[model samples]
Target: MGRSGPAACGQTVAYGLAVGVALAATVQAAKADPLQDPYGTWTLQAENDAVSTLKGTSDQYYTSGLRFGWTSGTNNQPPAISNLNSFIWGPGTQRIAIGLQQLIFTPRQTQVSQPAPGDRPYAGVLLATVNLISDTDVTRSVAGIQAGVLGSYAGGYQVQNGFHSLISDTPNRGWSHQLPNQPILEIDAGRTWRLPLITRYGISADVLPEVSGEAGDFRTYAQIGGTVRIGQGLDSDFGTPRITPGLDGTDAYKATRPFVWYAFAGADGQAVAYDATLQGSTFRSGEPHVSKIWDVGEFEGGAAVLWHGFRLSYTQTWQTNEFQNSKALFNFGSVALSAKF
Candidate 1:
């Protein structure tokens, strides 16, 4: 895999747009408005489809992901970001983040040496992202840009097999036919609105509805969803952090009390336009890929605990099959930890 490819032109444009969005709006970001001091926060998140671990086997289909991110304080953002965000959103607090992410996808038959007929091909993605979030108590808007690699260059073989070996699990034998190496570029943005339902006697509840999308050579889709949460500090933030193309969340949460907790559930539907993972190589001419199902649905439930500046959260996701002739339903788990500065 190399840096330049047939999508080179699209890559350049995506990079330029991402840079512009970052410089103008700041990055993915940190802190509730109350914690708007000069300092920021750091967060680490992981997603795995290890549900089959109990059976001493590996699960497949959008299997694993890891991301480390940081967000700036709600206040004290750079002048350029503040100005642009204010212009675009009409007066709101801003936070920015720059982070790296990795994702791995595989078919159910990882033990097979050859590609599975009519099944998704092996794929891996590694990317760097810049995110900017603007918030008003009522609504939050986000914009992000990402650039990186898809395929062998993403090190799926090393990371996946290494981890599998560590756990005495079978290594996926189909890496040789993984999606060819290619550059990936995506521009991501979304908006979320808060609707407060209850706030009294140290308990709070609210609804957050959103519409979002991503566009690039790697993937492009639009989604609509909402989450309802009931907890101690409903003002902390919208929801939990997600890998992408799904629900949205921030690494930072308001510290309303010494301890806080919440339970939440959400659902969404997607209309996918392009997915290189299913379509195979974006730049290469010949590759193996499965027939794609244009519409997909997903729902998730989770809980979180917030103690002062540190937050721990976990989510379980269920999604419909994304490929034609495949009736597999994917179940994955994601965990995230964050610390405020």
Candidate 2:
């Protein structure tokens, strides 16, 4: 079994490489046509969304022994969640676009503390453990508009697959990081309204079609859902954090800027509405499987100066009312970098 694991990973890598090469070739061939997108971009990011410890009060420093809990019916500890999302944007000439995004997070820490003034003085001491395993989430998409619909109708397809456990408490025992053959398919269409206020508002609807595949004796299944992202570009830094572990006399290696910035963006560039599906399904493989849907709304802004091919940027994103399984609510902040070509 140990030997087979590496072999399977190698095959997966090979398959991904083949797909990437094919995509590059197709795009290059279409470059001669005006219908292709000229907006090419690649960004590397370092993101950290550390959750505040389970405390007794909002403004106090008290602690709790029962820090971790399951979500409603689920019976597993919550997994520490963080994401390193990377993507490329190409707005084709035909009013269409394509994007590829990958989100990965690993090296999680789970710690708990005992109550103080107990029978033992060391009872209040903190006991924490770190997990070295890594998880990856990847998505590849291709979308376009109908050439004869007056450019009002547009739709595209996307495929997503990954091995990240959805569990929040028991991060180590969540699920076997298997490359299930199941992949999701998504399609969306909408109409754009260019307002007189120099703003564009797009109203769109999305759908997901379920897909199934065979992976030996264990069958893989995938279901579809839809999400809408009302995005607006910003050009200012609104109280963004400028300090990080690397620059604060820590031994951490230097990483790419922890935020993405847009020179043409304005203060009113934050996204107002965002929602999605398929986030609430519990895995039934063997160990405890939990699925919780999430509806998230966020505000973001950034600013920076450009020199040569590189730009220094600072950004901040605040998420609120993040719901899972319609039961629990949580929120976190994320910082990332944006590199433009």
Candidate 3:
């Protein structure tokens, strides 16, 4: 949990090197259209269970993500509606996207001290996702689906602890670790409606309803929820707001205004049938044996702003406890920056 000045400097240098490599890759691939579309976007996002500061205990995790997206300019084929296409690849305004994500989880000192034989290990997950998003109206209405795989790597605990030491300014106290290594399949869909009356006052409102599910060693459950947003609406697609990065294609570039901003809030509930992290299995093992909590809920609020072609957003979320005997409620924050070309 503690970090030395030299270690912090090393982490910074490493991050800078990563950014340099990404920039170089972008330049090298500039001539090739990865998405085969004229319109494209790139987004970078970071999420952490620790908001303003890092803590050693409950719900300690960090995630970093990058996404690339593209939209088709013209509909060359007739719109088709099928379970696979509707969810995997929307029928209307065709769009496709890909994302890469890294997640790390750490245990609290309390848990480490009173380990349950073989529990409380540091874990890390790496994921890659492919998504499809579309808008029939090309503005207000939108839908999307995403699929991805999650994998675990060695030395995740050590690597993450080093980063945490830098953030919390505490030296790393090594601990035992076990993480799930599995492939996950996910699918979801949503629709958004713009409120007509609010538009007259330079403010806009919309409601979105969505449902999603995941299958793998990580989780096996289904989720459904709705969200309402009110803000300065620019012509764009209604993108689902979540801690994880995904596709959010829009026609905002075509808007008359050069800047756009908005504030949003939402609630979602989940029926957790199974969670590998809590209830260990043959594939993955962990401590503090847990019972399946069928009901879980979350509340979130956030704001976003877009100027020229760059967009920035921030959100704060409070989550209900996930397992029994869990005393603290989980809270986290997410920040994202994106640009359209």
Per-model RMSD to reference: 13.6, 23.1, 18.6
Task: Kindly provide the TM-score of model 3 when superposed on the true structure, using C-alpha atoms.
Answer: 0.68
Total clashes for model 1: 9
Off by over 4 Å in 1: 1-37, 51-57
Q: Candidate 2: minimum summed lDDT over ten consecutive residues — where?
A: 150-159
Question: After aligning candidate 1 to the native by TM-score, how far in Å is the CA of 273 from where it should be?
Answer: 0.3
Pick by TM-score: 2 or 3, better one: 3
- How many residue pairs clash in all the candidates, one count each? 9, 19, 7
Q: Write the residue-wise lDDT of candidate 1 on 1-341 in tens digits.
A: 76786698789999999999865543323223323545588989998887332222255778889999988877677788777667766556788888999999888788899977888889999999988878866668888899999999999888999998999987889999999899999998899877779888878898989999999998999999999999887777778898987887767567667888999999988999989989988787679888888899989889999886888989888889799866555778889999988
Alpha-carbon lDDT, every model: 0.83, 0.23, 0.52
Best-fitting candidate, scored by lDDT: 1
Best by TM-score: 1
Clashing pairs in 1: 27-96, 27-97, 27-131, 28-97, 28-131, 29-71, 29-96, 29-97, 30-71
TM-score of 2: 0.30
Write model 3 residue lDDT over 209-288, tens digit each, in one string.
55555555556666666556776654443543443322222322222356777777777778777765556543544443
Using Cα atoms with residue i matched to residue i, what is each candidate's TM-score against the true structure?
Answer: 0.86, 0.30, 0.68
Give lDDT: candidate 1, residue 228.
Answer: 92
